[model samples]
Target: MAELTGRIALVTGGGRGIGRSVALSLASAGADVAVTARSPKELDETAAAIRALGRRAEAIVCDVSERTQVDAMVARVKTALGDPLILVNNAGIAASAKLTDTTDEMWDRMLRVNASGAFYCTRAVLPLMLAAKWGRIVNMASVAGRAGAPYIAAYTASKHALLGLTRAVAAEVASRGITVNAVCPGYVDTEMTDASAANIVKRTGRTEEDARKILEGFSPQGRLMTAPEVAAMTTYLCSDVARGINGQGIVLDGGALQS
Candidate 1:
């Protein structure tokens, strides 16, 4: 039998990039999946792909930063496919600016979406996991969470808060059969990275290709990490085999920031 044959998973930001990949990966592992994001079109595509894998799937439109929306999304998932046994907090946004240039609005927005969004979603689904005595929670964090970087203070701070939440919750639930962990990938090949590169081009007058190369150069492997690679790690963490792995931030940056 498949590892997660009877489980249900909820993946936020499931419309595209790593979230979409993780949702599909969980479905492939035999779990029914419900995906949430703001984009109906992308969520529909992701849901369609999961259904093609023969697993039950639901696509929900949600803005995770709002507690009401998060609660509603989880309730909808429960009604559609039972309580989610696995939760992937992948909904996030990023922007780069010098610390002095960063606005109050930008800082607030960063924490609202990247950190608070995960907290709200996790809080909503945690009760079901605790009651069942089994759960896997994976937060899609970033390398910035671990170390400092230039021009991304707000993004970095939000991710650090997320990691803090991961450790605290993992410790809280360690004895309760629930594991919480984070995946911190550096410079992923996603639309988010593309936007970053575009921003670089605009600010530095560098060609798009050169801007991309600059981002890729951050990883020792000289390439951006693929969504499937992150998804594979997330799926493994959600499996029975990974029950012992908890409260960890597994880095995937090709040997960068080893500590």
Candidate 2:
């Protein structure tokens, strides 16, 4: 935990869910945190939690999909804290639609927010990390990226592309003491999943328990993973002991689809 003491970290989409948990974890471990989200309220709440842990926190309003805002966010974080050495590319979007029903707007939005967004933020922070010669980047991916799911073509494809980007970047900077990796989680009890589950129950006319079990069928544990559980894996990946683990996509599936 003390390994991150004095480090500057940036977490995108830190308003809630796994992103929020990751931000708190970093702050608890002694890192200064910069939290970015479209919603200022969520960002403020995250910042408050970080400060409660006795660490510096910056609540930056940023839409990672927007290059201008992302750039400004980087500058603000650096100005307020320092050059971020740890980055959690946790911002992502999800839309559920079949292949034929998936509109171009949905596809574009997913690519922009889930894929391009990660690229923009990471690119913005690279200079400082390169100068320091040490960094940790953890991208939030999903099991859908590894195992395709129905009614979420855009989200699945975006995550698939994100994993590719994560691997490619990890290779390019592996020699420079920078680690870029992805953590792919299975179904988590987040608002997004709750909505998806509700839709499943409505569409299939099944009991809530049955609908949940259907989702659980993807995991051997037959349950959804927790946000803190996913955060733990990410926190460990950012640790000094995990310096050699690069270009790896660690699955947080609870044995989902057991590859």
Candidate 3:
């Protein structure tokens, strides 16, 4: 039997990057999936991909940073696929800037989208999971959450706050059949990384490949991590075999942080 047979999952930031990959992974594992993001077109594409995998799918246009929008999106999911058994808080944004140059708006945007967005989605889904007594919550954090990075203080701070949120909620729900965890990846090969590379090119006149290699250098493998690699870890966390794993932050940086 498929590992996730009969499960219902909701993935925010599902329009692209890691969220889209995780949504497809969950659907392929037999979970009816609901994908939410701000882009209608991208959401449709992800939903169609999920449906092609033979699982029921829905696409919701949502900005997770907004509480009302999140609440509404959850309500819609409940109506379409019943309460989601798995929630992947994948909606986030990243900005690169030195601490001294970081504007208040930049800091707020990072915290609001990357940290508070996860919190809102988790809050909206908790009731459904509690009622059912079995749930999986995966927060899409970053390596910056665990360690500081140069010139991206705002982004790093937001991820740190996300990890704190993950740990605290995991503790609160430990006794329940719910597991809350974070998946931290370093320099994933996604649109976000491409944008970062472009920014580097504009700033330093380096070739795109060189800028990309700079990011990939963070991983011991000397390559940027793939979206599917991150998705596999996420799907595992939602499976029955991972029931024992709770309140943990699993790093997928190809041994970058050997602690």
Each model's TM-score? 0.98, 0.97, 0.98
- Which structure among the candidates has the greatest lDDT? 1
lDDT of the candidates, in the order given = 0.96, 0.91, 0.93
TM-score of 2: 0.97
What is the per-residue lDDT of model 1 for residues 170-209, given as tens digits with 9 covering 90 to 100? 9999999999999999989999999999999999999999
Q: Which ten residues in a row have the lowest lDDT in candidate 3?
A: 1-10
As for TM-score, the candidate ahead, 1 or 3, is 1
Candidate 1, pairs of clashing residues: none
- lDDT of each residue in 1-259, candidate 2, tens digit only: 5369999999999999999999999888889999999999999999999999999999998889999999999999999999999999999988787799999999999999999999999999988889999999999999877878778899999999999999999999999999999999998978878777888888889988888888777678878889999888888889899998999888987775565
Q: When superposed on Cα atoms, how far off is each prediction in RMSD?
A: 1.0, 1.1, 1.1
**Number of clashes found in candidate 2:** 0
Off by over 4 Å in 1: none
| Model 3 ranges with Cα > 4 A deviation | none
lDDT of 2: 0.91
Q: List the residue pairs that clash in candidate 3.
A: none
